[model samples]
Target: MDTREKILKAAAEMLAEDMGAKLSVRAVAARAGVSTGSLRFHFPTQRALQDSLLARIYEHLLPGDPIRDPALPPRERLLNCLRQVLALIGTNEDARTAWGATYRTFIEPEPTEQLRAAYLRHEREAERRVEHWLTVLAEEGALPPGDHTRNLRFLLTILNGLSVERALPTSQSVFLAEAETLNAAVDFVLSAGPASPVESTQP
Candidate 1:
């Protein structure tokens, strides 16, 4: 492999499995089996290397990565999709955590434009899915009719806050309980319509 590619790979590996040691240029070069000078020649600065790595990892964690299950009904599919997104916030070893550390990099006052745009796009896509499905069900009288756009934004805000907060020093129970509250909030919105008997088909 080329020297540039080798250095990038080594930096990524160091960042893997929740290790934060990947930011060191010397360490990264050693891991890549290249001289520190070689790594610096390519990256020039640590910020350049760190920013590039963060972009790659964010793509991996995008909401679109998880395709909806065809076996489930539309509502269930949407709920399951949201569940998967919320799952990103947890500290459980089983849950995805790379996004956590990468997010920390962007918390600085002046994150790069690329990073900011990527985050906004993900946030919008997430809100769109939740708002669209809820709006459809509400119009069909299957779900309680209410202001879905505002509600969807509120729910997503919960997710954003939790993901950022739990990424810091926190506990797993907080995530689980937060997920429960979110699930209940969704259910409550579903039940907001007039009390009328309707046959629901399981997806």
Candidate 2:
């Protein structure tokens, strides 16, 4: 394989082995059997490397992402994407285990710097994925023109709530409730009017 590809492969393996360790330029270079200078030439900064790595992970996490399917309605496309995120949390025992791990790592006790950084990295990745979905819809004129920051936050908040509910006991049909909630959230964002454009000062 090519030098750049080799470096990326090595980095992906390292990430799979440990989510938050062995990502430094020196470490990746050593793993890839390439010089640090070569790795630097391919990825100028750590952020650049991490961004590329995360993009690769996203692809692996969702191959042939449903968000890119043009045949699906915009709302449906977005709902499908959101559902994929929740699916990772699984259901019943799997969901409980995921929540337990989260509490131990982030909630019960104060998180250390390493733990905090790892959490932030994951949070940013999630934000990036949502932003990309909005951008795709906006490009197709399927989404209204607006500052999507609020919309992004709204969707994520809904998702977080839904994920929490997965581990809880509820009388209602969780699947039906989740579908209705996701549909309502998607409709609310999609039906909103465009943001007001800033007036230009030039005469």
Candidate 3:
């Protein structure tokens, strides 16, 4: 990767690991195998680096809207929607690792204004993503008519809890894989709503 990309990637990895507290120009430069001068050339300040990292995280987390194919069975479409939500946790070890880093970067407390701004930006992006899917489902007659904003908040709340649960030792102790957890969450949402009954086909 180019130097700027390398710096961003290194920063992202650090943030994923909850090393945001320790991030510094020098450390990022070392991690990227670039000179501090080079790092500064691309990102002259920590806020600049942080802004770039936040954008990258959003890009990774908020993948463009899922395909809402009308031809697919309702259950299939709902499962696809749920999987899209669960995808935020990632689908594999590498992805989960990257997600861990992102989670750390997102929730870890920081006093900097830039960090707070980044956090809010990420929050809005997350809400937009959830709102987009729910709206699509509603338009497709998959979701029952109701207050979408409230529904979005409710789902996001549960999703946030599930995300945190995945990071806990208790979840691993119970062998609760990410997919199973997500599937269960999705099932609950689909079954509780006016959405079609879930098919036996695995998500």
Candidate 4:
């Protein structure tokens, strides 16, 4: 394999083995059997390397992301993408287990600097993914121009709430309520300003 590919492979493997392990230049270089200089030549900075690794993970998680499909209405495409994010959180026992693990690992005990950094890195990655979706819809003229950062935060806030709901007991089906909430959130953003006229596909 090529030098760059080898470095990425080594990095991915390291992460798979232990998601919390730091991907330091020296460590990745050693794992890849390449010189630090070579790894630097390919990645230049730690952020560059991490971003590439996360992009690979995201692509694997959502190959041919629905947000990019022109055949579907933009609203429907965005909903599909958001639903996929929730799917990763799972439901019922799966969601409860995830929450329990998170609390034990990061909350029950004093979190170390390394642990905090890992959590922040994950949060930033979520923000990045959400921003990418908003950008795509704006480009399609299906969404109005606005402060994308604010919009991203707003959307993620709703998602975080929905994820928590998945872990809790409820008398009614959360799926139907989740869809209504997602639709309302999408509508609010789409109506924030005058979007370039696009043909309506919504019933």
Candidate 5:
């Protein structure tokens, strides 16, 4: 494979391994059988490398293009978008571990400024993805007009809570399947913003 492809493949493998959380440029270079200089020559900076890896992971999880599918009902499209978000959070053990590590890094007693900035950038992209889908619904007259930013935050916040709950051990007192919970959450969020006139008047 080409040098850039090799580096990215090595990086993806690293993120799936136990050492994923402790990922560093040096470690990635060593694992890829390339010198640090070669790695930096391709990636230039740690943030760029991290972003590339994240983009790769996201693409694998949701291979569909972000463009809205006009053939599908708009709410179905929204649920599909939100389902992709859930997959990102609770797809597999490797992803769950990586997410837990990311959370730990950010919530440290005094997270480094660099870490905080990088995390914020990562989160902003996720929020933007949700907003983009919602914006499509709004434009198509499938969703009500409202504060896009606030609605984006609200949906993401609920998904975040669900992710955390999924990671925890189930209690005898309370149990909800992921499908049931997700469907209910999606319904509630859609309800908050009244359906567009076109949808409301439909059979």
Candidate 6:
């Protein structure tokens, strides 16, 4: 693979496999089978390498691609989008660890600017995706009369919080039970919006 691809792969592996590992230039160089000079040539600093890795992770999580179920109605599409986004909140152990570390770095008062900025960007992208999906449903007249963006932020925050709780032992059961919230959220969204054909066609 090319140098850029090698760096990205090395970075991703390092991030996934060694979240606690201090990502030094030499460390990444060794991982990629490249020289420290070569790695530095591509990424001038450790923070730069991490920012690149975070960007790659963000792309993997949400590429901004259109919804996969093209034939579904706008309400279904919106709900599907919400489900997919919520599913990113570390459902499994590895994911839980990765996101936990990420959130730590984000909340730290002394993390490098690169890490903080990258996380802020990721959060913005997340909000935009949620807001965009909400807007789509609103335009289609599928949402109820509340402030969609604020309501979306409220719900997405709950999903993120639940993901964190699931990472801990005492709250795992609570998080599992909260699947009902996701179901209730869909019902609320649909009921608040314009009637679905499913609704209108019912005898």
The 10-residue segment of model 4 with minimum total lDDT is 189-198
Question: 1 or 2, which is superior by lDDT?
Answer: 2
lDDT of 5 by residue, 1-203 (tens): 98788888988887665322445789888888999999999999987887787788777888975438777876677767776776666644645675678666676437777666656766877887787777777787766766577668777887777676656655432234656766776677666764333445556
Expressed as tens digits, the lDDT of each residue in 32-57 for candidate 6 is 99998998888998767876776677
| Candidate 3 per-residue lDDT over residues 80-197, each given as its tens digit | 6666655556434644575567666765555587677656655665677677667677676767766566656666786766555555544234225645765675666555654444
In model 3, state the lDDT of residue 129: 65
lDDT of 1 by residue, 70-165 (tens): 465545655665667766555554333645455465554366676676456445556766676666666656666755665676667766666655
Off by over 4 Å in 6: 1-68, 109-115, 144-147, 171-176, 189-203
Higher-lDDT candidate among 1 and 6?
6
* RMSD in Å for all candidates: 11.6, 4.4, 10.1, 7.2, 7.7, 9.6
What tens digits encode model 2's per-residue C-alpha lDDT throughout 100-202? 7778656776777877887788788888888888888888898875577877888889988999899887667599989999999988878873355569999
List, residue by residue over 51-137, the lDDT tens digit for candidate 4: 998898877876778898878998888889899999888999899987777776567767889888877887899998988899888
1 or 3, which is superior by TM-score? Answer: 3
Name the top TM-score candidate: 4
Q: C-alpha displacement of 125 in model 1, angstroms?
A: 1.8
Tell me how far candidate 4 lies from the true structure as C-alpha RMSD in angstroms. Answer: 7.2
lDDT of each: 0.63, 0.84, 0.67, 0.86, 0.71, 0.67
Q: On TM-score, who's better, 4 or 5?
A: 4
Model 3 quality (TM-score): 0.50
* Model 2 pairs whose backbones collide: none
What lDDT does candidate 3 reach at residue 68?
64
Q: What's model 6's lDDT at 44?
A: 91
TM-score, every prediction? 0.45, 0.80, 0.50, 0.82, 0.64, 0.55
Evaluate model 1: give its TM-score: 0.45
